[model samples]
Target: MKAHKSKTLIVYSFLLLFCSCGLFIDKDCFDSNEYKFYLPFTLSPAQDTFHINDTIRLRADFSHELFDSITLKYYKVENEPLMCYFYFFRIDTTPTPHYTNQFSIEVDTGNVIISPDPETALRYIVYEYDKSRYVFSVKFIPHQRGVFLFGFGSEPQQHVNFQKKCPGELMDIYFTTNDGVDNNFYMMAQSPDSSMNAVPQHGFNRSGSYCFRVVE
Candidate 1:
């Protein structure tokens, strides 16, 4: 009886040791911090007034940092770290294009180097990228005269101001982060960009076209 009790005590002690060391307990350090995802990207040709028929380029090189920051903040010292982020802040890779007819976008294959191929689905434009890794560069041509709202789920947001080639500087063109779908939003503006009613493009999904404009 004494020997049996000693063996049971040893087993219990071992279990307790493992549990205290977190070997048998929660080993993954959870990351609830959302601010680490707020990596702002810069828009090429940062302008207060981008004109029609202009090629606007977008580039950002903080994807690796965005992931690493969370990894470091949440689970750097853990034996087996399971890092989880709440929101995604990269290019929105919608199966269907989520852009306005005012501008057509494409990856700058010449200036930008995408290795192992970036992501693009059937009938999807190059704008639908997985992540703007390293130097993610893309160019968009403005086809019409109005403001263009960036698509929802599109993150690492970029803020741009547009001024049409009009007489008085009354803020005719603009770029925004919110598409105003279901009243969900990321960044909020002061007066709000004019809601350019959603519409279907040549051969794209209308609902995914989360961009709007104010043409006067």
Candidate 2:
């Protein structure tokens, strides 16, 4: 039974990657004339911390129009029942903290979609958006109370070792430099809770991070 499910899942994944919107690309990817890129815009939260039922605004601005298309991925953060990586929820005694399982808030990307909806959405592009070029914005209300994080990369913590875990969210920015440049799709993501910065977050190796706390 498990094997059959796996096969079905694989099929769906292919459909989403191939059938969805299309290949991600940009015009000005790597221009020799244009040297330095950027964090784009700092994703500054409304405040350093939030409270239950408090709405948090996460927004960033672009200095230049770099992304002809940006693939924005989201996970249903609030009111979600399932929060496990396994195809099926794991049956174990491991105390997986709520923060470790999923994001803390419900995200609403207002009509920002560049990809078409697939028949079996469960298989690919979980949730996608790229319509906006000047700004990346979302409004969410916290569901859980504690220090929760978003995005991928690595951090070290004592007692338990966690890295390369599934991301809370991910953004793939395809440049539209319109200039002869190297082929590279830039990425923007946040770091989950950890101590050591093992991988790149917010574009570079610990260039910066967005860590938030929620209270009841």
Candidate 3:
């Protein structure tokens, strides 16, 4: 009877260990999934140069392995009039067509909020078609003049690390010349928490900033 009891206890202990290991694996999987969801998208401009008070249009695009709904956030430095346009294209060969509602908010304090238009009651379909892609454009008139930067990312907050300040990842796009001359291209990054020291964030992960210099 003593031997049997010892065996039972051992078996129970093994089961407990297995369960704990399973929980640990599950937690790791959850962390990876969350990280991918927060991954930033790509923001590109048609051109790098723009004149002061000129209407600038920027293109934001993203592609994912799986079809996931995404919302883009746009930021600017100077308070200016802003407009956003969204386009969805189904890359798969099919007769049926999918549509997503797009919406944009009025410019306020150098920031604009854009999302799927609620009036259409449509969600941006990603996985329904092969290699689906979404493209959006942001139009704004720069009131201030100088070396200015603007960018779009998954994060809604306005934060970007400049070259001279905190540098890590390419977080924003710079616009310098208006006539497509004297264009500057570089990477900028910022820490999610401003209180932290000016250190490169690990994995080059952080929020984005729209830094631009408006010159008269």
Candidate 4:
């Protein structure tokens, strides 16, 4: 019995030692005062704007004292609300046509460089009708038919304004000659650039004219 008890005691002593060492290893050293607090990550080109056919640059920053290596994920707004094409901002490599993937980088002991490639996301609409007439439709309305206008435009501020002055807030105006389907009218406008509208040799001109009707 004495020998059995001694063996049990030895086993208990070994178990206790193992558990104590494991506990010490699991203890977090990062919360201690020996290590200073530093920002681990940063994002650049945080606030920027882009026009058609314009390119934007982006960057990421990090601290050497904080991390040994890092893995980053990139994302951008797509065709739902805003249309934008993202690309890689590679200084050493050639530019690509598409950007729909996450790029990974290995940081040595110091800084990791990440470059963003942003291209024009949206395209404006312009169509040709005749020498004196042109058609234009954009995602957002333009304040006035002009070469360049930014942001959302007012409906009334358009080249041809539509208003309801009748008893009801909504009114309709129509004319009939031969048949209801054959007699209809559509409003048209001219392009902001007169020369771009049509060829001058064809005697085509748009002089801020509106309320033009079409016969079918």
List of clashing residue pairs for candidate 1:
196-213
Candidate 3: stretches off by over 4 Å: 1-49, 66-134, 151-216
The Cα error of candidate 2 at residue 141, in Å, is 1.4
TM, every model = 0.39, 0.34, 0.33, 0.23
Off by over 4 Å in 2: 1-36, 42-46, 63-133, 152-208
- Model 4: residues >4 Å from true position, as ranges? 19-48, 67-216
User: What ordering of candidates by TM-score runs from best to worst?
Assistant: 1, 2, 3, 4
Cα deviation of 18, candidate 1, in Å:
3.1
Q: Per-residue CA lDDT of candidate 2, range 1-216, in tens?
A: 999999999999999987653434222222211111222323334345667777655444443333212322122222111111101011111221323222333344322221233321111111222342334445556665555433222112112111122222232221211121211112111223222233343242222234456678
* Candidate numbers sorted by lDDT from highest down: 1, 3, 2, 4
What overall lDDT, based on C-alpha atoms, would model 1 receive against the true structure? 0.33
C-alpha lDDT of all candidate models, in order: 0.33, 0.32, 0.33, 0.23
Query: Between prediction 1 and prediction 4, which has the larger TM-score?
Result: 1
> What is candidate 3's lDDT per residue for 65-149, written digit by digit as tens?
2221221322222211112222321212132122332122223212333355644333221211123433343455655333433
lDDT, candidate 1, 50-152, per-residue tens: 5667776554343333322333442111111112111111122222232344456677642322223223211221222234333345676766554443431
Clashes of each: 1, 12, 19, 0
Which 10 consecutive positions of candidate 3 have the poorest summed lDDT? 75-84
Residue 6 local lDDT, model 2: 100
